[model samples]
Target chain A: MIMQTIDLEADGLRALNATLHAQKDDTNQTSWEVVNAKGSHAIAVGLDAPIEVTVRGSTGYYCGGMNKQATINVQGSAGPGVGENMMSGTIVVEGDASQYAGATGHGGLLVVKGNASSRCGISMKGIDIVVHGNIGHMSAFMAQSGNLVVCGDAGDALGDSLYEARIFVRGEVKSLGADCIEKEMRPEHLEILRDLLERAGADAKPEEFRRYGSARQLYNFDVDNAGAY
Target chain B: MCGIVGLFLKDKSLEPKLGEMLTEMLVTMTDRGPDSAGIAVYGADAAGQGKLTVQSDDAERDFASLAEDLGTAIDAKVSLYQKDTHAVLVAPADKLDQMRQALRELRGNVRVMSAGDTIEIYKEVGLPKDVAARFEISKMGGSHGIGHTRMATESAVTTMGAHPFSTGPDQCLVHNGSLSNHNSLRRKLRREGIRIETENDTEVGAAYLTWKMQHGSTLGQALESSLEDLDGFFTFVVGTKDGFGVVRDPIACKPAVMAETDQYVAFGTEYRALANLPGIETARVWEPEPATVYFWNH
Candidate 1:
């Protein structure tokens, strides 16, 4: 696989991303190096082919938004919506990430080696997010499906209006949101957590973390749940 | 959405580079807001003297010979320095109120942005880089400063509506979210004798903090009180005579990042705003928790 180097400082964000989007599936280019990111927004979006892209510096909003099959790596921090609505592939951030790191993602692996700010995984569908550091408030809000693993503390309202998503936290949870409750970490859950931890290169043991999910009481409409609404 | 950037130098050796570093941080957030921009700088203050930063739409006509006229009217020594649409008038500290009153009666078109011993504010309706260049923000030196770029969701785009609203003598605030109850709050604050100039919701937030602090609450306490009093999503970066403080609403909706190093403490709506700081690579960066007030003082 030949690697292509795209310098954002020289080529600009739109041109570089446009070139990546234009590549054919059978094209010889399979890897890309993005130099001097310097906090540019929408660096890579809507790629369907299996390619590897490495960003050399910090990025602004929506670094890998709606990614399909590209493995994106940020050597430094990222702004909001790191992998928003991603369908498949992997995104790894070596430094901290801002709000809504993996918002509404469907099927992908998003890993943040440092802290993720507020609403880290809001409305997640089927994505797998692993944060090695703390996460801010209202993370995983109204999540429909997916897995979020936080190795550090989570701020207020961890999972408001949660649905079928599974949350694993290794540190303290300030508060849980409505309909989200702490549940037992069963043997099969530990096995999945261990795999996620290993895949994300997190050092924490799976057994040390706790699990949280929807209470299922709000899943069906009932007169008794009207007060919660 | 709006963008805010603040820098408070812990090391005086980095003072000379404050404006340049802050300008870079502010310009990086141009995409977040494009309507208007403003900045407040805390420079060296002479004892017994205070500064009044004012802006006029017609700077040429309003600022010409204004210092001479103000000195005669208020019976105090006044020195004026003009930069683009803004001017800083230095006068005796004891005569500060009299000078403000005289200016208001003499020039109805000039609005006082701030009056304090150390602070000066410059703002205009334009892009952040253009506004910064118009005021020559990079050429000035200060110990600390704050900047804001507005997208104008809740108010009109006017010069007086720009951010870094200075409702207190030595204090200002730049906010990134809207206040749901600003109309009622504005009326209430005005009923209490708090002067608010613009229809901008952010100005009401600044005025609320000033009113709280004037009633003897410390800056941190006033910020703490705002978490309960101010309604709606907000991330506020406030500047005082010798301090810089940050606070987010209980829900923590609007984004805010803080970085602290041996040389300086910086605040931004996002981390990219802090990327160009002097020692940011080694700085301790974190998101300010919801309803928490973080402040640093000289």
Candidate 2:
């Protein structure tokens, strides 16, 4: 097992991020440190091999953009566009993230322990992004294909212009977007959510949650249902 | 405290670029600072130096005569001069250095500020829409401009109380939070003969930086000085005619974040306000730094 530890200082963080080529399984873990890392875009990028990277504190923008088969974990918060345009990987944030997390992801799992800001999974292609806390407005706008699960409340205009992506909410929804509907809950969703929670390390009980999914009616174009959508 | 809208145009025509979006963004943020509001539209037939700001205390000397004297001192035509405010503007971004020098030549309580290309704000207490409606804002068109809405605090919310408060000839400030050391810094500035206006703590900060800019200190230096000198929980969006500036408190109490892309860069009190931009892409979003001074050329 090959392991790497970085303190997230300016010099060390820059030096480490400057030379991260996924040759084999690489694991980098960061500890608690007061690092005034401001606006260093694309903190982690372009990794195809299966590697695990962890940042213990809060991070700036695009923490794991353009990722491929890498697992990134943050014990603290992350900025906007975390796990953006990801091909395949797992990015878990233990705390709240700014707007647009897991945006345009092709395939991967993004588990956020806390609430997410507006447009949580915009234009998502194929991904499973789970949230334990409430989400802000326009959570799944223009989603092509994915699954966005929220255990808490969702803001106005939830799942606007959704396509093929399924959304499950166990809490209140302020408003529904175009082509989105609240469907019936079932037993199989409970098992799926429980497994996702276990992977994300959520402490909520499975029984307290409810399920939601795509209505499938909006998947195909219709002339009469124009106003409904 | 005010509303600001900036547009970066790839083409020369500034309009149709930010005409509608700027109106929406400014109107949405109107509730934040509502003492006064004004828009500096930069587009076609636009002069980089929109107006001349004259500051003076010549006993009984008239503001119009002061403008005439400034015109004589600089040997230029004073197109519009009203009660301590004067403007001798040119078009098409041609006279950059001469305009800066012409404004600087006339010395009185009168100072010509931002001669190259900028908007001079003279605000009063009112709603943003009414105040902006009073002034015709479509003449001075350029690629980008900033607007402000203010609420009075320490001093009265007078014409001077409004913001994009010009702390210097080129620099202006519009703050969202309060300053802790108001009286302490106010006394210091007063003893040094710097006139203090408005009881708002934001003005103290504005004056502190104004004094520094007048005395040849850079805006960055003034901000660094306030980082240690003035204590408070503050978030401000400051800038010059050609640049952008941002800063926040050390404790991180108030929230201020930026969402940027190839086309536009926007900062809002919250993320919900700036969610739908002109051409926002999924992968080109990020938050600006908190509790630090951030700036850009845009």
Candidate 3:
């Protein structure tokens, strides 16, 4: 139950993250509380723990990489690759996040209060992402499997080149991915989105939201449509 | 999260098979909905008149038990269309009258529409093709039709909450978006026993229009009313026996592309999705006007 609170000034938070990474071997479930984290990069990398890391300000790229059983929390917006290649555990952001917040993550959850930039959850394998704000283009690009929940708007080319993943967007979207199509809007989605929004502390009503997903058009390949998305 | 496709090919003579075409299309969009898969096909041989096609959960349950259960509440054939989570009942062409009685029977909102001889719907934990294949639904040769895909969230992955819901009679709909005022509407729709099968904003949306149809309003009139009454972001494609309607929410955050060619018309979440559908030339592509509902009939 030991807690470590680090406040980064104009200097980089790399040293602190390195310190946290070094502490990953410890048995204790340490809580890292970071303050004044302005656009810091690689804040928490190569950490495997039953511990928790919290970033209180804006963060830069690859905030949480190669994660294994560790939990990271960002109080504000995060730059790209917030939880890239995370094997397990959870990462929560209280505000909007930048691009690639959870790129190539294989497991766990990434919760964001605001919108995300391009490739927000690109190439995700088994991660569960819940975003309260809008998401930029190419989210879940080439994703293999996972769940992505967006409570706000979505930019163009959402879920492009996706595979076996489940995505729920409560707001508007500029476009859908290639090989994506419209399906029926059924009741199951309302209840699911309702629960997700409630869990994320979003204000949008589950019933008011319509469901947008894959059209199941490209499960197998065809020669005539090889060039198509 | 999933995608779905259903076709009731009324014309048996159409070459290349409508069922195969729809299934292929469904399979092509697996990336849009890929949790699970199913599809339903009703050939011309199974065709019947004055029917309401429902593609919902409990496909195994016999239509007799379902119809008998609601025998006293509503006046419609609850049998015939049963595929997993979907059920298509053939009701009176006057969508409003049947809807009023339906409201008094079910506990939850049923995504309902009235249009023609065929009502197509598919939904589930997987992609659109999976849902369509579940019920052997291969083709829909009616004058018009409806379809949908799903990405799960607050609800469970089940057949009941799938798309292309029929509001009795010959009407059906496919939706993309959410309703900000769904709870308020659900209360009103359920007050009369219109038992909602699932807990989706789409059910509420369908119910809103079903209520209007039940109260002696034409499909177009009902959609016009909904333009003012409903809240949230959405784009909808509705179909009937003779024609269809398309509408967008007042604040269209969802993407719905509109395409028209000399032979056919289509819409999808992304232009790329419809890259090869019918007259898919770049010049015919267009985005739907936000917050406006337009209907087409032959």
Which candidate has the top score in lDDT? 1
CA deviation > 4 Å runs, candidate 3: A1-229, B1-17, B36-48, B54-116, B120-124, B192-194
* Superior candidate under TM-score, 1 versus 3: 1
Cα lDDT of model 3 by residue, A1-229, tens digit? 6788777664456677666767655666478787766545677777877788888765666777777877888876566578888888777887666667788888877888777766788888888788887787778777777778887887778777667777777778789888654455577766766766676667878665555556556677877667765
Please give the range of 10 consecutive residues that has the lowest summed lDDT in model 1 chain A: A22-31
Among the numbered candidates, top DockQ falls to: 1
What proportion of the true contacts does each candidate reproduce?
0.32, 0.05, 0.00
TM-score of chain B of 1: 0.98
lDDT of 1 at A125: 98
Query: Candidate 2 falls in which docking quality class?
Result: incorrect
Candidates sorted on TM-score, descending: 1, 2, 3
Local lDDT at A43 for model 1: 85
Off by over 4 Å in 1: none
Off by over 4 Å in 2: A1-229, B1-20, B38-50, B53-74, B81-117, B138-140, B153-155, B213-217, B272-276, B281-285
Q: What's the lDDT for candidate 1?
A: 0.91
The count of residue-pair clashes in candidate 2 stands at: 20
Predicted candidate 1 versus true structure: per-residue lDDT over A1-229, tens digit per residue: 6789999989987889898998777867889999978777898888877889999988888999999888999998898899999999999999999999999999889999999989999999999999999998899999999899999999888899899999999999999988999999999999989999999999999999999999988878999888886
Residues B21-129 of candidate 2: C-alpha lDDT, one tens digit per residue? 5445555557767766544343433443345444333414535454455456556554554432333344234434444455455443444333334545534457766
